[model samples]
Target: MCGIFAYLNYNVQKERRYILEVLFNGLRRLEYRGYDSSGICIDSDLSQPSIALDPAENGLADGSCKPLVFRQEGKILSLVRSVYDEADSTNLNLEASFSVHAGIAHTRWATHGVPSPRNSHPQSSGVGNEFLVVHNGIITNYEVLKETLIRHGFNFESDTDTEVIPKLAKFVFDEAKTEKGEQTVTFSQVVLEVMRHLEGAYALIFKSPHYPNELIACKRGSPLLLGVKELSEDANGGTSFHDSKFPTMDGQPKELFFSSDANALIEHTKKVLVIEDDEVVHLKDGSVSILKFDYNKAKNHGGLPRPASVQRALSVLEMEVEQIKKGNYEHFMQKEIHEQPESLTTTMRGRLICGDSSKAKSVLLGGLKDHLKTIRRSRRIVFIGCGTSYNAALAARPFLEELSGVPVTMELASDLLDRQGPIYREDTAVFVSQSGETADTLLALQYALENGALCVGITNTVGSAIARNTHCGVHINAGCEIGVASTKAYTSQIAVMAMMALAIGDDTISSQARREAVIDGLFGLPNKVREVLKLDDEMKDLAKLLMDEQSLLMFGRGYNYATALEGALKVKEVALMHSEGILAGEMKHGPLALVDETLPIIVIATHDACFSKQQSVIQQLHARKGRLIVMCSKGEGPLVCSNGSCRVIEVPQVEDCLQPVVNIVPLQLLSYHLTVLRGYNVDQPRNLAKSVTTQ
Candidate 1:
């Protein structure tokens, strides 16, 4: 997971300074994708052309310990520890934008390459090595190319999938220079020519000496955006995008910022165009042109998705998707757990913006005010979902019922369709799905609609089937989720339900209160998520304790009951072990028989309405000689049971419904850590893909 950005074309010096600021802030916004080192390159001031143009040229610095080549062994993080710049995340003097017209910057969460300066992107060639490039995603086959290049007299620098781009780019250009007149074709063309030889996924931005006027970018199964803006000279010496680029007008700047996602473009210019797969972007002079790779062997590859668009600046709604996979953390699970706090914050932001400890007696239902009123008059409400979405619905039932003074019932779509008759006539139904296209959930929504229920879908994907089917529903705004066993999406769905509960409570809060509470929470979420990351060591420790255990019994009550189920599902999905989440009350009837010193029981006892009741279950597990691990709110500790045999994890405090937003994070980490500790493949768990499109 990495963030990439580039700035090209600047008539004014002040514009360059502003560009760097906007670009850096944007990368920082997307730091959730894990990376150890970061750096940017532009036309170097010290850059000089090679004196020897022929392959026979010699007398160049090439080796480990030299200024040019990067040598790294061991794990990616360990190598990063040796050379990474602590102050700038390996990208030093980030304010340093070269005098050159085009530049490329990178935040490296290295995958195919070791994390070192040599492996870092914006790699260049020639005497001064002024030309630079930056990249994200995997270039799956590097060893073969590196081997081929080694035989053909390419002096290898770093062992990275990324180094191939710069090396091959220059190689193609250098070889072309001998047969074809250099003036006949530009460097951007050479880059595309080099791209023809590439296989696997990547989204890159670069500048070559041949075409100094343009910033060249390309995408394949990863994300990139070309952001356009107009520049205005600052009154106080700071630069600003010209008036035309701002909200008052549009289409002003040929000046632009490019990135894999919007966060990097948001701080620069809200106006952006998302680059699609295999599409090449030539950005310069305030405009963008999309191109294709005619020379590539697989020019007609069909796996590539439809191209993305240049959209406007997105808020926390999309930030959830942005944060979960590629943040500065080592893995998507890590970033997702760390995102719990913000996930919780975003969930509570819009509806409870003003309420304090007193909680405004009821929810402030606005857009749903009329429908919620009608729903309140109904006898009961049915919540439908499948998989993780179902777990979230299970967690949300009591909160929605209690806060709105309406009855709430939850069920799994697969089960609801096959096992029993669904509720009918005038009842309200909320269908939850991260990808609204979920087949089982969609069928359930159809069933509810046919039964005459007022169907509402709570989903992340905007235009999916469920969203289209629902009369009026809420968007979780979780953005694109790239994991099979849902992490951030689950929490996003929970947060959306919590906000909807608050909104459905009543519609009386002033807009001022809504903005104050929600907007502030949105901004404050990064810090809250930071708090969750601090618990990483603790969760890892817990995972170590339970590593050898064959079975795990997770229990929670109120909003966390579903949280318990989701946590258990994560362990089974990633850890490949037997785990089950049951209601605390259900244990006395069945699971209590399984409790023993050999069985590990995980309890979700966060400080909420059901803490006391759940604690009693923990007490029984301890009395039965069961290994007890509890996740609870920070402080109010003294977690020792009457039997004095228990372990506990404390997370940052949040609202009851919002508790799942933070509470489930530690559980996700617990699974990921356990899997990693056991040497399992965390990214591609057996029989899983990032998306489940097939039946």
Candidate 2:
């Protein structure tokens, strides 16, 4: 839920101002991940220190210069203001340059403590503030570790689990020095030792005066990547790295950027290496070396592995800077909502074949082609995800079952873990997530893996953990979704899953015509979405009418049931309103009691297999004098709203299975408008992160 960014340059001089700007901008790019506080730590100009500090207070036994740390309890702008304010008050020269420097910055989403400056990241050790560490995920055993450190006389300043990391590193560093006598104990060694005692997911960057001009970045069950910028003037013009070739350790003008998200690094360098689980990367003297944590070796060395380098190839980030920008839209959520038409098109690109005349319409998902045979033979297919991803799976579930003739089950990743559900080798588990780094989903995936079930990933992120760990899967290719509330990615996920269904059901002769109809619907879906977006102003008008309402209720059945859930989720998530999505059949059971003339209810009456049931629901709501908002097919509003009293949102009709794609657009617009009217942050939302990286 937090964002981690660090900058290091070797043999290349940079002014403190530029370094600060880099760090600040990096954090700004990752604001989408959601954070309540921000902080940064940079090398202090040794010759002219900015902040005066006592040796004991600063944890500098050797009287070394303490790093410049600035932390604020609000946005990144607040942290920037504090830094500039301090510079102006102290007459500090930010233009002062350093030939070799390192800095780490973080935007923290509070977990261990409340959002405050003391709880912000760039958390330091107690003794001398010797080690500064910025972390992304939770530390499950922090209480135990904190108790040990407290017994060792290490006091803490903040109530964060992250505070223990630097303290732990210092403790390990001191013990290593004690054991080695006069022998040098490297930062990597101390970090490796620290990793042994840590339990939980985290992406960490460690900086210390004890090991100057070096930065150690590591990750376990969290996302982290290193961007390499070599200014060596190679024949390739430093644009791309050779395939599978590691950069030389030669002394060259180089810069290294580390971030929990690729969005922060894409602008600086496209050539990056995704740090996998349990891998530690040490950057020093313009050279980068990777070390893998080995349980066997660690057990032998008192739970600290000896240094062993591992080879990893640098992958080119395919995303451009422009993809993350909000463009003419007011918010990322708005931009993404409006981008659905193009995103759906992108999801179907090169995969849907209309079969001009003789080819016979078909769907080809290259990622799933090799695994289709195995999937078809599986006893069952389980779809695992969280939030919007989960809803998307639900929307695609019925069609997948119809096409593949394989029983499809939906699982919320967390629930699956809580149940430790039975997953057999004959089953195929599909994990869906926009970021693919969702902690619960990844943990569930691990559970499925241990059970010998084939795991598949459907994600928008390319180098995410789910994408890397899965046997095979599809990329949603919905572009960068920067909003905490998903829009385009959700639709794209459904489209991809629909295609997966088509690919699996292609062998059935009886369903040939049905498959071709779906393919045609898939081809026409984007246009239908484009047509439905014309209702934006109408939805906005509807939102205005319901802006002051206390609650919302949505009802649907069949495929559009997911639409109802997703629509209500959008309202609750962004509009800051209480909303519920009810199945039409279950409305009378309980949800109907909540309906009244004052309470707003949205019913999906779109033409589908469940149209009659939805129509019956509308009639029941009308009989109860419920405030109704019906999302029906264009020109079919009269059929559902015969009384002419219920507010109607008419959307273009598509194949019954594909109707969710068209049905969701207007609701997304309504939610966006409602959020703006309710004075809530449309993109960030309150207390929510774009990627749920922690349980």
**For residues 79-192, what per-residue lDDT tens digits would candidate 1 score against the true structure?**
234433442454544354532256566666656555666666556553445244677766766678778766877776665667667767666666665676433445456666
**Which candidate should be chosen as best, given lDDT against the real structure?**
2
Q: Estimate each model's TM-score.
A: 0.54, 0.96
Off by over 4 Å in 1: 14-28, 47-100, 125-131, 233-240, 243-255, 285-287, 292-475, 478-490, 495-553, 556-562, 565-601, 604-623, 627-695
Tell me model 2's lDDT, rounded to 2 decimals: 0.88
**Model 1 poorest 10 in a row by lDDT:** 59-68
Against the reference, the lDDT scores of all candidates come to 0.63, 0.88
Ten-residue stretch with the least lDDT total in model 2: 47-56
- Candidate 2 structure quality by residue, lDDT tens digits, 1-695: 79999999887778989999999999999987756999999866563233333233443424345687889998888999999999899887799988899999999888888999999989988644589999999999999999999998788889898988999988877666566653267778889889888889999999988677789999988899999887755676553322324655886677889998888988888888989988999998888989998744675675346777988888888889988788898999999988998999988999998787768899989999999999999999999999999999999999999999999999999999999889999999999999999999999999999999999999999989999999999999999888999999999999999999999999899999999999999999998988998888998899899999888888888998899999999999999999998888999898777777899899998887888888888888889999888989889988889879988888888898999989988889999999999898898888888998987
Q: What is the C-alpha RMSD of each candidate to the true structure, in Å?
A: 11.1, 2.7
